[model samples]
Each structure stands twice: as C-alpha cells, then as structure tokens.
Target: MDVSCAFATALDSADNIALAERLGYHRAWVYDTPQQSPDVWMTLALAAERTERIGLGPGVLVPSLRHPMVNAAATATLAALAPGRVAVAFGTGFTGRRAMGYGPIRWSFMESYLRAFRGLLRGDVVEWEGARMRMLHPAGHAPPRPVEVPILVGALGPKGNKVARELGDGLFATLRPPAFMTEHSWVAYLEWGTVLDEGEDTHSEHAREAAGPGWALSLHGAYEFGGPEAVRTLAGGKEWLGVIERSRKQRRHLAVHSGHCVELNAADEAAWYAGGSGTLCEVTLSGTREAIRRKLDDYRARGVTEVVYQPCGPDVQRELERFLEVAKSDES
Candidate 1:
C-alpha cells in the first residue's frame, strides 16, 4: 500500500516539509481550516519548493466557502508551481461555513460550484455572476495553460459517494471503511493516525483510544472561534442557551468519566485534541515493523491504494522520522 503523510497547517514549516521529503513520503496533505491554520495555497507553494518529488495538495477545501473563480485562480497557481504534482479535493464545507455564520449549502449548489471549478482547471470558460471567465494563457503557459491536476471529492455517505464517482478523479474519505471505495470502483484512501514506535502496549492503547466513542463538536468550537457575539446572534438566545446547557452537562460527564479536571467550556477543546490524537494513531500503520506490515497487508486486502498517516499531538518532525523508518522497511 502507498503511504502518504497528512498534516494540518499547524505543522507546515519548511523544516517539516524538507524532512518529510527526505523520509520517502509519497505525498504531503495540508488541512484547510480558516481559524486554526495557515493559508493552504501558501503552504502548498512552500512545501512544493522544499520537496522535489512528494505530491502536495489540500486534504480538502470547502467549495461553498469561496467563489469558484477564486478557487480556480488559486488552484491554477499551485498547479503551475508544482506542475504534475498538484491536486485538489472539494467538500461541502459544513464546519467552515458554520464558523463563518453561514448555514450549510445544498449539495446541488456545491455540485455546480465544483463543476465550474474543475472546468476552469481544465481550461474551459466558466460562468460566474453573468460574466464568462476562461484561462487567458497559452497551452504551456501559466494560468490559462492546461494542467492535469486530479480533483478528488470528499464523500462520507452513499449520495456523496455517487457524486464523487461521477465527478472526481478519486475518493478521499476519513473514518470510513475501504469497502466503501471498492464498492464504487474508485481508488480508496484511508485517513489514519499513526506513530512510529513498536511497543505492543502503546499500539494497543492507541487502538483502544481509536475505538472510543467521541462527540463531534462541529458547531460549538467553530462558532466559538467565529466570535462570541456572532455565535449568540446566529444561534439566538434560546438555541444558544440550550447549547450552553448541553455543553456543560456533556463536559461534566466527560470529566467524571475521564478523571480529568476541566471546565465545561473547555470540553470541546479537550474532545477535539483527544479525538485528533486517537485518529492519528488509528489510521496509521504503527507498532513493530512486522505489525505495521501486517496492518498494511490487511488494508491492501481491503483494496486501499493509499493510507494517509496524520500524526497527532505536536512533535511532527519526530513522527516524520518514525514514519520514514517504517516506509524504508517496507521498501526493503
């Protein structure tokens, strides 16, 4: 199975990219969230310049968050910088939009947005706000030039999967079984968390943590970061008050069960961190070389073409080293 490294904007330093390249990672993905990370395009450019062969792209970007024209332009620029190595994945942007006070967009509108975005990437003219905009350069030139940047679609359910099959170059999903992609005849990628060590106890603990039930605080923290007053205005007095009450209750329960001292207001933060770490460990091929090889073999049996390893917690450089060692072992 092919292995790639996944990272958020938090770890997109030049040093990190250079190390990942030397370590034999096939790709480096950057998460696109406004409040928590650096700009995706800028980070991709930096990564591309720092690495020679590792493919770079946004793990996924919200189509509804930006106008199609803007996305087309940004993607075109990135593709030019990296030539054949750039790719893009588009999603509905539920969390991102909510963070900006906008409700979730309908799939129909999102589909149209993706169509236009992809069209522009293929050097076709796209209609935007009654004006037609096409790439304005020659075949080999930048901007209007043609570049084969694959577009992957992030789909979590049946309908979304169908759309991905119809429109995307491949499937990009998280927390889903590989069978989902195999059933659709699309190349499958499983997003997993992994560490480089081989301690059986550590791997077992990580597996358990991955299996633990978790809550998705999509609205709470996204809204909180959007702004305190904006959240009040969007959620209103009654709904907002209800969320506050529920959050408090959930926090108390979590604190009691987890044996941690944390305020009700801090529950979202805690859950996010814990879930992130768990996800990193669970999605990756970890443990001893033999154990990791077995895990990868299992995924290959399930028809997974690529497994993206996202390191949890800080210390990204150390994780990259560990991951590189695993990759080198597989090569041998």
Candidate 2:
C-alpha cells in the first residue's frame, strides 16, 4: 500500500511536507481543524510550492465552514501547483465544529454539500445558495479545465459511507475499514504511528504518549456519537467509566482538540496500553518491521489502498523520521 503523512497542521507544515517527500512518503494530508490549525488551503498551497513529487491536500475539509465554490477555487489553486498530484476530502465537521461549541453538520446538508462540491470540482455548473455558479478563472492562468481532482469523504458510520459512495471518488477513514467497499473507491486508512523496534516495554510509555491524540479522539467518538455502550468496549472504559460519564455530563466533547483532550486520566492511558481500541496494536503499526509489513498486508487484503500515518507528540520530526526509516529499511 502507498504511505502518506497526516500532519497536525502547524506553521512548519510545509517544511514537514517537503521532508516527507524527500523521505519517499506518497502524500501529505493537512488536517482542517482550524481551531487548532492554520488555514488548510494556505498550508496546502505552501506545501504544493515547496514539494514536487508528493501529493498535497486537506485530509478532510468541513463543508459547513466555507462555501463549496470557495473550496473548489482553493483546490484549483493547489491543483495548479501540483496538477494530478492533488486530491481533497470532505467531512461533516467534527473537531472543527465542536471546538466552536457546535455540532456536526446534518447528514442531509453534508450530502448536498458533497454533491455540489464534487460537481464544482468536476467543472460542472452547480447550484449555490440561490443561484447556479461555476468556476470562472482567467484565461491561461486557470488550472486545467475539468481538473480530475479525486474527491474523498471522511466517514465512520453507514450513512456517512453511503453518502461517500454516492458522491466521492473514494473514502478517508481512521483505523477501521468500511463494512462494504466498492471496487472503485480508494480507502485511505489513517493510523497513529509505525514503531517496530523492540524495547524493554512492548507498549512503551513513549509509544502510548505518541498515540494519545488518537486515543483521546476515540474517547470523544465513543462517548459523544458512539454512545456509552461503545465507550464500554474501549481500553479503559470499564475502569474509567466515571470519568467518561463526568465528561459526558459536562458536555466535554466540545473540547476535543489538543491542549485539552491530552489531559486524560492516568487509568485511561493504562487501559489503552493494555489492549483495546486506540492501543498500539489496534491503532498503530507496532512490532518488528516484518510484522508491521504483514499487518499492512492484511489491510491490503481488506481493501486499504493508502495508509496515512499521523505522527503524534512533541517531537514530530523525530517520530516521522523513525517511521520512514523503518518503512524504507523494509523496502530495501
């Protein structure tokens, strides 16, 4: 499977994208959570200008944040720089909205947004707020007409997947594969890390800390959208149900991004390391490099085409280098 890097979206993101290309990563997916991130399009434009081979994109843009026409224009600009190397993914806005004390866009609205957004990207005139509109770029300076930008949709549940299948060119997901995947859909499976070196602790504290973001996200998903029953199946659900309950009672899902979610209970961390969703075993590539490769083989068997590995923690460059070194070593 092809490998991509998903960034946490910082000012140095363009630099990281350039370095990722040098290290042979296939692409760079910039997160769209503006609450904790810079403008996605600006970051992508910078990356596009700084790199040649690597694909550049917003991992998943929230349709509710900007007009589809605006998104289409920004994507065209990036495509102008990267051409066939560009793709954009859309979602119903999770962290982006919650961080603003709002909720995800309704599925109906998201479905309509996807249709309009995909149409605009395909060079079709689409209906806007009240009128039909199409991209009207200046002659010659315009990116190629009818740009074949691949549209992906970030989805977790059945309804979301259905919308993607109907509107998107592919799927963007985390950890789990869809229940049913069409032959034409490309699945980008987002993983937390790829740490294979054997150490004193199989699930080291460093590794656990490296995976904290995803673990914290899982808690948000389980408690908010997935319900208490889903939360119960997670690593430390039983032991930390009280914490989860308290958070739920207080509507803590609103603070689901970094600088807040990472301040998790210690018990939750231990449970995640023990085994369950968000554990190194479940969400990351951990073990010998050979073992990690075998795990990747399993994903391919299940229809995963692209593996987007997201680096977590403070030392992102170090973690990224370590991941690429192991992946490259295996290729040789």
Candidate 3:
C-alpha cells in the first residue's frame, strides 16, 4: 500500500510538504477549512513550487464554498504548477460549511456540481445554478483546459459512496475503506493518531494533543450525521454532548467543530481529558508502531490503496518523520 501525508494547513506548511517529498509520501493532502486554515489552493500552490514529485491537492473540498468554475480554474492552475502531480477530491461540506453556520451539502447538489465542475475542466460550457458558465482564461493565462487530473470523492456514507462510484476516479474516506470497495478501486483512507511509545498511555498529554483534534472529529461527525443522539453512543459521548450544548457560541453548530483537525478547543480538550482516551484506539488509527503497521496491512486487505495519515499537535515534523519511518517498515 502507498503511504501519503495530510496537513492541517498552517502558515509555512510548505516546508512540511517539502519534507514529505523527501520522506517519500506518495501524495500530500491539505484540509479545506478556510475559517480554520489557509486557503487550500494557495497552500497547495506553495507546496507545488517547493516540491517536485509528491502529489498535492486538497483531500476534500466542500462543493458549496465556491462556484464550479472557480474550483475548475483552481484545479487547472494547480496542475500547471505541479504538472501530472495534481489530484483533488470533493465532498459535501463538513467543517468547510459548518464552521460558517451552514449545514453539510446534499448529494444531489454535489452530483450536479461535480458534473458542472468536470465539464468546466474539460473546457465545456456547462449550466451551474441558473446560468451556463465555463473557464474563460485566455491563452497564456492558465494551464490549458482539458487539464486531466484524477478527482476523488470523499465520503463516509452510502449516498456519498454511490456518487463517488458513479462520478469519481477514486474514493477518499475516513476510518475504514468501505466493505464494497475492491483492491482495483483507487481508495485513499484518511486516518489520525500517533505511533505511541511502548506501553504509553493513549490519553497522555502528548497523545491528547496529537490525537485529540481527530478524536473530536468523531464527535463532530456523529453530531453532523446522526445528531446529538448519535454522539451519545460513543465513548465519553454524553459529556461531549454537554460540552456542545453549553458552548458559549449562540450557534452550537459552529462550536461543534471549533478545533477541527488543527487543535483541540476547550470543549474538545475537556472531553478527551475527562475520559476520551479510552476509545482513542477504537475510533482512530492511533497506536504503537506495530499496531499501526497491522492496521496498514488490514487496510490493504480491505481494498485501501493508500493511507493518508494526518498528524496533529505542535510537533508536526516529529510526527511526520516517525510516521514515515514506520510506514516504510513494510518495505524492509
């Protein structure tokens, strides 16, 4: 299986993308949360200039954030900078929309947007919203249209999976590769957590800092897809629900995803510090080197072609180096 790296997208993050290229990560993906991080395209653009071989793109873009023509243009531009190394994935908005107080987008809208976006990439004029539009970059401005790059679909449920199956070149998902996927399919499974020290506590301060944001995402995902009731079913779910309900923000929707994959907010830190560590290994791919290697093996068995691991906390370089060392263990 191929190993890839994903960044939470901080300022000066191109350094890490450059490091990933040196470390041999097949692709480098960045989160697309504008409110929480830098612009995805701009971040990738920097990475493109800094590195030559490692693939670059947003792991998953929220369709509602921009017009189809806008994204089509950005993709073309990134391809120009990175040549054949650019690839992108799109999804119904998660934090990308919710951080702005909107709900996740619908599949119907995403399907339509995908069609229009791809059409625009092909230099075909297509209808979006109420009017026909196409990329109008004059010659010598952007990469030539018909800029062919692989587009993946980020999904975690049946509806989104169906859309990916029909419209996308590959599948990008969190947690596990869906059972329906096969080895022939291009599946990139996004995962979180750290390679723990021998016998180290999963809830230790370091672990909490590195894995907390990702664990918090489980709560955010549950609350987003299944509501408060669903979040109540996970470990420390009840207390987390309380944290969300009592958030100072007038709109709890925004509070639910405050830290996202970057850092743990007060609510996220509290919940994980309270008892969230108990299930860290259960929900996330965080564990020891041996354990992580096992998960990589299991992923390949389940049709995952690439493992896009996103590290968290203050020491990103440390995490990146360690993950690459272990991920390459299978090679030796």
Candidate 4:
C-alpha cells in the first residue's frame, strides 16, 4: 500500500511538508476549505517546489467554488510545474462550499462541470460562449493527450459512488467503507490517522486536541461500531446532545440563508457518518499496529488499491511520526 499524508491546511506548516517527504509519504493532500486553512492550489505549488517526488493535490476541490475553466487552467498550470506528480480530486460542494459560505450546487451541474474540466485538460476543444478553447500546449502529441493526470472523485453515497465509477480515475473518501470501492473497482484512498507505540503522549495529546471532539467522535464511532448508531451510543450524554442541537441550528441557518433543504439532527449526523442506508464498519482501519495491519490486509485481500492516511488531533507531528513508523514496519 502506498502512503500519502493529509496536509491539514489549518495546522500543517512548510515543516510538515518536509517531514512528510522525509517520512517517505508519496503525496501530500491539501484540503480545500476557505475557513479552515491556506489556499490549496498555492500550497501545492509551493510544496511541488519543496519536494522532488512527493505528489501534491487537493483532497477534493469543490466545483461550485470555481469555474470549470478556472479549475482546468489551474490544474494544467500545476501539472506543467509538477509534470506527472499532480492529481485533481473534484467533488460536489459540501465542505468547501459550506466553509466559504456558498450554497451547494446540483449534482447534475457538477457532472457538467467535470465533463468540461476533463475535456479541457485532455486538450479537447470545450465550447465556451459558442467558441472553442483547447489547452494551448498538450502534454505531448498522443491520442488521449499525454497529461497522465488522474482525476479522483470524493464519493460518499451511491449516487456519488456511481459518478466516481463512471467518470473518475479514482475515488477519494473519508468515512466510506472499502467494500464500496471493491464493488466498483475504484481505487480506495481513505483519509485518517494511525498511532503505534507509546512515549509520544504530548504529540498524541496535541493531535487529539487538534482533531477536536467532532472528529474524534466520528473516527471512534466509525472504527468501533461501523455506523451512526454506534456514534450515538458512544455519545449518549448531554455533550452529544449539545453537538446535535448546534448542528440543527446550523442547518436552520443554512436553510434560511441558502434555502437548501438538509436533514439536520443527531440522527442525521449519525447517518452521515454511518452509511445512509445501513450501518456497516467492515472496512474502517484503526487501532494498534497489528490490528490496523490486519484490517489493511483485509482491504488488500478485497482488492483495495490505496489507503491515504490523514492524521488528526493536536500533536500532528507525533501522530505523523507514528503513522510513518507503521508504514515502515513489517506489516505495512
């Protein structure tokens, strides 16, 4: 399994990028959240110049945030700088749009945007205002345009998964199980962290604190119980109720502002973390090194292509080091 680091734009610095590269991480995934962190494109550009072989990309960029033409141009520019070391993962505006105070766009519109974006990247003439625009300089003179850049999709539900399978070169996901990828033959690149050994208490504490309660609750529930019921069960106190109430308020505010109807409740959050249809934790990899290895082996046995590790919490460096140790170990 190839190892990739999740560059938390909010927490990670240039030093983190250097550390990731030194730790033998193949890629650094910068998130696209305006409120959370730095600009993903700029960060990736800088990271490209910083590291030789480490690939850089947006874990998932929102189509609604920028025009397809802009996305195409930016991606093309990045590809020019990094050559074969860039990947673009596109998704319907969820986190990115929410963070930027933009409303969500329809799935159909996202599909159209991706089609146009891919066409532009492939050097095909895209119809814009009754005019044709093609990539001025193609990767090389080849039948398919030799850019060799892979377009990944952030797929969660069946509709998203179907879109990814139909249109994307790979699938980028966080909470979704590995079985979904196996069923579709899409590359499964999961996002989360793993810790092994002890004595890094300060680092672990930092990571946990940085991860926050929501992230920890989600991860704990996902790994332990497989679905929202588990999350609900684990968060059965007033603390969880407070979070649910806050989410409801947020949903109400969202509805008032954007008029987008969304189910908001503890159950809704649970359902989002758990598979919408049912609860299943058959593919979440967490816990100790041996346990995680066994879980990864199961995923590999099921034909999982990749597992991207995103370290969360307060002590990111410590968690990163632990993740590296596991990656370098015999089981990995």
- The prediction achieving the highest TM-score against the true structure is 3
Model 1, 1-332: lDDT tens per residue?
56777765654454576677787777777767664566877888888777788888887788766788777778887877887788787766544454444555667776777778878878788887788887676655564555577888777677677778777888776654535767544343634334434444432444323312221222243343454454344322234334444546434322222211101124333443433323333433445666666676666677667777665444566666665566557657
Better of 2 and 3 by TM-score: 3
Model 4 ranges off by over 4 Å: 11-13, 100-104, 128-132, 136-146, 183-186, 196-207, 210-214, 217-238, 243-286, 330-332
TM-score of each: 0.72, 0.85, 0.95, 0.74
Badly placed stretches (over 4 Å) of model 3 are 248-250
Q: Mark the regions of model 1 whose C-alpha exceeds 4 Å error after superposition.
A: 98-104, 137-143, 183-190, 196-265, 268-291, 327-332
Model 4: lowest-lDDT 10 consecutive positions: 255-264
Candidate 1 lDDT at 208 equals 29
Please list the C-alpha lDDT of all candidates, in the order they appear.
Answer: 0.59, 0.74, 0.85, 0.60
Model 2 Cα lDDT, one tens digit per residue, 1-332: 68788987889989989989988899899888888778999999899889889998898899889999888888888888887899888877767787676878888998988788778777788897889998788766557567678888888788888888888888898746666554434988877754646652445667666665565566666655777688788776665455444555445554333342333444455455456433555555665667777777777778888878887776777778877766666555
Each prediction's total of clashing residue pairs, residues at least 3 apart in sequence or on different chains, is: 7, 0, 0, 10
RMSD of 4: 7.0
Q: Each model's RMSD to truth, in Å?
A: 8.1, 3.2, 1.7, 7.0
Model 4, position 248, has a per-residue lDDT of 61
Q: Name the candidate, 3 or 4, with the larger lDDT value.
A: 3
* Lowest-sum lDDT 10-residue window in model 1: 255-264
